[model samples]
Target chain A: MISTTNESDPNPNESTLVEASPRRAWYRVDDFLAMGLAALIIVTATVSALLVRPPNIPQLVQDHQTSKVRLQQLDPSAESFSADRKKIIKQQAEIESSIATMPLKGWLVRPGEWKDDPRAAFVKSDKSIATPLLATFGVLLTLFAAVSFVQGQSAWRFALGFCGVFGLALFSYVLAGQEVVKHYNLEYALWAVLLGLLISNTIGTPKWLSQATRTEFYIKTGLVLLGAEVLFNKLLALGLPGVFVAWVVTPIVLVSTYLFGQYVLRIPSKSLNMVISADMSVCGVSAAVATAAACRAKKEELSLAIGLSLIFTVAMMVVQPFIVRASGMGEVIGGAWMGGTIDSTGAVAAAGELVGSVAKDVAATVKMIQNILIGVIAFAVAIYWVSFVEPRDDGSKPSVMEIWHRFPKFTLGFLLVSLILSVIQSQGIEGKSLVSSIVDGTTKSVREWMFCLAFVSIGLESNFREYRKMLASGKPVILYVCGQTLNLILSFLMAWLMFSKVFPNAASELLAK
Target chain B: MRFINTGVLKFACACAVVVAVWMLVLPVVGDFPSVRQRIEGNRAAGINPTAVFYTDHPAMADIERSIAAKVNAPTGSFWQFSARRPK
Candidate 1:
C-alpha cells in the first residue's frame, strides 16, 4: 500500500480533511469585501432610521419632486380629478397634530404649508444635512478599509482614495441641487457619471483608486436595498388593470425586443442584445444591470446601456410632460404610459408630477409594479442562459449546484427583504408606515448614495475608447432605439386598453378614492 | 455576413414581418372609442391647468424667490450672453 492515506488513494480520512479545509473559516477576498461593506451600510441605515427619531416633519407640497413647469401643463381639473386637495388638508392636519405631540415645535423644522397644495412652501431646514455627511464619511471610510483588507493591500491608501472619489461625487450632488439642474431633470446620477468621466479622461484615474472602484459591488448593494422599496402591496393599487398592463405587456415586449435585437439586428454579442432589450423593455438602467449580470454581460455593455438610458431619460423627462398635456390624455393613461416607458423611477415620478398629482401618483405606482418584475426577469434570464445559451460543449448539462453557484445571490437578498417588508405591510397601516419610514427616511438615502457611487465607479472604470468600440458598429444604438420605440408603442397600447376598456372602473375607483 | 446564416436570416425576416403586422394592428386595437372619449373629455373641459403660485404660503414664496435668486444671480451674465448668445 503506497501511501493509502493520501488523497489520491481516496482515503476516507484524507477526504474528510480535504472537505473540512475549505469550511475552516475560509472566505473569498472579493466576495467578503463587497458583502461585508454592503451588510454594514444596510444594517446601519435601517437601525439609524429606526432609533433616531427625527421630528415627525410632514412632507411639503414644495418638496414634491415634480417641477412647477410640468405641474402647469396638467389639466386644470387635475387638482380635482383625484383627492389632491383632501389629501393636502389631511396631511397638514396630521403634521400639525404630530407637532403638538412633540415636546418643542419651534426647534423642529416646521412643515410649512404649500401656498398651493402639493408645492413646497418653505426652505427645508438644513438640520439633517450634517448628519448625512458625517454618516457618509464614516461609512465610506469603513468600506474602503474593509475592501483594502480583503484585497490584501494598504488600507489607508485606499481609504484616502475613496475620500477623494466620494468628494467628487459629493460635489456633483451639490451641483445637481442647483434649481436649474433640478428643473431640467439633470439628476445627480448624470453629474456623477460626468465627473467620473472628466477625471478618468483628463487627469486619469490614479492606481490606488482602483481598489475602491468597484461598480458591481456598489450596484448590487444598492439593488438589494432597492428591493426593500419595491413593496409588493403597492402593485395592487391599480388592481387587475395594472397587473395586465405592467405584468402581461412587459414580458411580451421584453421577449419580442430581445428577439428583435438577436435576429433582426444580428448583434455580435447576445449579452449586449439582452442587456439592451431588458433595459428598454423593463425599468431602464436598473433592469439592464440585473439582466446583464444574469446573462453575464460585459462591463462595457452595461455602461453603454446605462449611457443610452440616461440620455433617453433626460429627453423623456423633458418632453413627455408636454406630450401628456398636448394629447389631453387623462392622468391615469398618461401616468401609466409614462411609468411603463420611462427608465428611471425618479424620472418617471418627475414626469408624472409634471402631468399632475393624479398622473404622478399613477405613474409612480405603475413604475413600482413594473419594478417588481426585475426579480422574475433575472431568474428567468439566468435559467435560460444556464440551460440553453451556455450549455456545455461536451453536451453535458450543468448540475443544479453549478447553476446555483453562478446565480446572482444579491437577487436573493433583494427578494428576502421584499418578502419581509411585504408581509409586514400586509398586517396594517402601522406596520406599513413603519416600513415606509425606515425605507424612506434612512435606507433610501443610503441607497441613493450607493447608486451615485456606482455610477461614478462606472465612469472611472469605463474607457471612452472601449465604449467607442462597442458603439462602432452602431448596432447597439439601433437595437436600443428600435426596441424603445417598440416599447413605447406597446406599453401605450396596453395602458390604454387596460385602463380604458378592461378596467375603466378600476381607474375611476382610484380617482374616487 | 459571416454570422448571418440561413436560419438567422429566416428568423430575422419572420420577426420583421411580425413587427410590421403588430405595428399595423396595434393602433386599430388601441383606438377604442372609450379612450378617445376620455381624452376628448379632458380637452373639451376648456381649462388649462396653470402652476400654483403659492401666494398663500409666504414661506413657500420665499423659497422660490431664493431659488430664483440663486439661479439668476449674475456672475458674468451680460458678457456671457453677448459672447454665447451673440444677440
Candidate 2:
C-alpha cells in the first residue's frame, strides 16, 4: 500500500521540521519551485538558440528540399540517383551543423572516457576539464542555493553539503567513463547509487550533508528538462509499423505485468510493483523515475526498481544480439524486438547495431517512440492513483479538488515543455534544427547532471537494512524477471507482425532512408 | 579503533570488489574478439552505446533528417503521373 502521509520531505534523512509540515500547501510550493527553475533553463536555452541561428539556414533548407525532389524523380537503381541521394544527405547534414548553438555548449561538460589512469577522464588533448567542471558546479550551486534560500533553509549549509554530493556525482561519472565499464553499458546511475549507499551505510551520511540530498527535487527538475527532448514528431520515424510495435504492444505488457504482480505475485507495495512494471516495459530508469514520482512511491522502492533494471539491462545488452544472430532473425524484426524489450535506450541501440544498420535505425526509432509514452503513462498513473489507489479515510469518493491537490505538478511542466518544443520543431526543417541544437548543445548536459545528482542523493538516503527487508521476499526480483519475459515474447511477436506480415515494405523503406 | 569497525571493513571489501570487477574482469571480457569489434565499431561510427535518448546518439540526427526529407518530398513518382486519369 502507498503511504498517504503528505509530508514534504520524501527523504527520511531530511530534517524533522520538514516532515512536520504534512500539508498539501507545502508540496505545491516545493514542487512549483523545482518546475519553475527547469522552465527558466529551457526557455533561456531555446531563446538563445533562436537569436543566434545563422541567417543562411533557411536558404540551405530550401536547397535541401529541391534536392530531395530531384532525387525522387530519378530511378533508385541508377548511378545519378545514388549521387543525388548522397548530395542530399550531405546538404542536410550541412544545414543541421550550421545552426548556431546555445552559449552553454562548452561550459557544461562531464568527465570524458578514460582507460587505466583515472586522470585521463579529466584531460583531453592537453585540455583540462577543470574550467568547465567548476563552471557547471558554480551554476548548479547557485541555482540550488537560491531554491534552498527560498525554502527558508540556510544556504550556507546546503551549499557545503552540495559540494560533497557534487563530488560524489563527479566520481560516479569517472567510474562510468572507464573504458571497460562504459563498453559494458554500465551507466553512471548505477555507480552513483552504489557510492551513495556505501557512504550512507558505512560511514553514515552526515546530518549536515542531508540538507543537500533532495532526491525528488533534483529528479523532478531533471524530468522537466527531459520534456524538451520528447518531440512528438519523432514518433513517425518508422511510420505505422514502429507505432504498432512500440505504442500498441508496450501498454499491454505494462498493464498485464502490473496485473500479474498485483494478483499473482501479490506484491504488498503497489507503487513498487508499478514502478518495476513500467520501467521494465517502458524505457528503464527514466520511466521508473516518472512513474515513481506520479504514484508517490517511497525512495527505497524507486532505488530497488532501478537496481533491478541496471542488472538486467547489462545482461540483455550482451545476450540479446547473439540470440538474434543465432536464430537468423531478420535485422528489422530483430531490431524492433530489441528496441521494444531492452529497458535502456542506449542498450537498445547497442544490441540493434550488433544485428545490422537497419536494425540500429529501427531499434533507436522504436525506443524513441516508446520513450514518448513516459508522459502519457505518468499522467494516467497519477489520475488512477488519485482516484482508485489512494484510500479515502472518510470512505467517500474522492473529489476533483482532492485529486488536483495530490497530483505531481512537475508532470504538467514536463508535458507542457514537450508540447511547446514539439510545436517549435514542427515549424519547418529550420525549426527542427534549432530545437535539436538547443537540446544537444546545452539542456541535455544539464539534465544529465541533474539526474546524476538525484541518483547520488538516492544512494545517500538509502539504507542496506531497508533493502534487506525489501528484497527478503524476492518478489520484486521475481516480478521483474516475469515482466521482462513477457515483454520479450510479446515484443517479438508484435515486431514480426508489423514488420514482416502487416507492412512487408516497411524495413526496406526505412533502409532506403 | 573507530575506523576499523565492521561497517568500515564491509565498505572496504565492497569497494575492492567493485574495483576488481571494473579493472580486471571487465577489461579481460572486453578484449574478446566479438566484444572488441563491436565496441571499436561503435566508437569509430561515433555511436555511444551508453546514450540515454535518441538525441544523445549522433546517428539519430541523420536518420531524422532522412525521414524529414522523405516526408516533405513530392508525393508521387514522375512516371505515375496521368495514369488512369478521367477522360
The best candidate by TM-score is 2
DockQ, each predicted model: 0.02, 0.31
The residue-by-residue lDDT of candidate 1 on A1-513, one tens digit each, is 311221211111110000101211224333334445555655654555445443533342222223333333334346562344344334443432332222111221212211111123223452334444656567666765665565555566657667766776676665454333333344566667766765666555666565456566666667666666657765555566567778888888889888988888888888888888888778876687678767767666776787787778778876887898999877888888998888776567667766776676667666767877887787788778766777576888878876665556666666777778788767643354456555544555556667777777767766678778889999888887887788788888988887666544445534443
Clashing pairs in 1: A61-A118, A61-A119, A61-A120, A62-A119, A62-A120, A121-B60
Give the 10-residue window scoring lowest on summed lDDT in candidate 1 chain A: A12-21
| Runs of candidate 2 exceeding 4 Å displacement | A1-28, A124-126, A511-513, B1-4, B16-29, B66-87
Residue A411 of model 2, lDDT score: 82
**Docking quality category of candidate 1 according to DockQ thresholds:** incorrect
Best candidate, lDDT-wise?
A: 2
Highest DockQ among the candidates is held by which one?
2
Task: Enumerate clash totals for all models, in the order shown.
Answer: 6, 0
Tell me how much of the true interface, by contacts, candidate 2 captures: 0.33
Q: Could you give the CAPRI-style class of model 2?
A: acceptable
TM-score of 2: 0.91
What would the TM-scores of all predictions be? 0.69, 0.91
lDDT for B79 in candidate 2 is: 14
Cα deviation of A124, candidate 2, in Å: 4.1
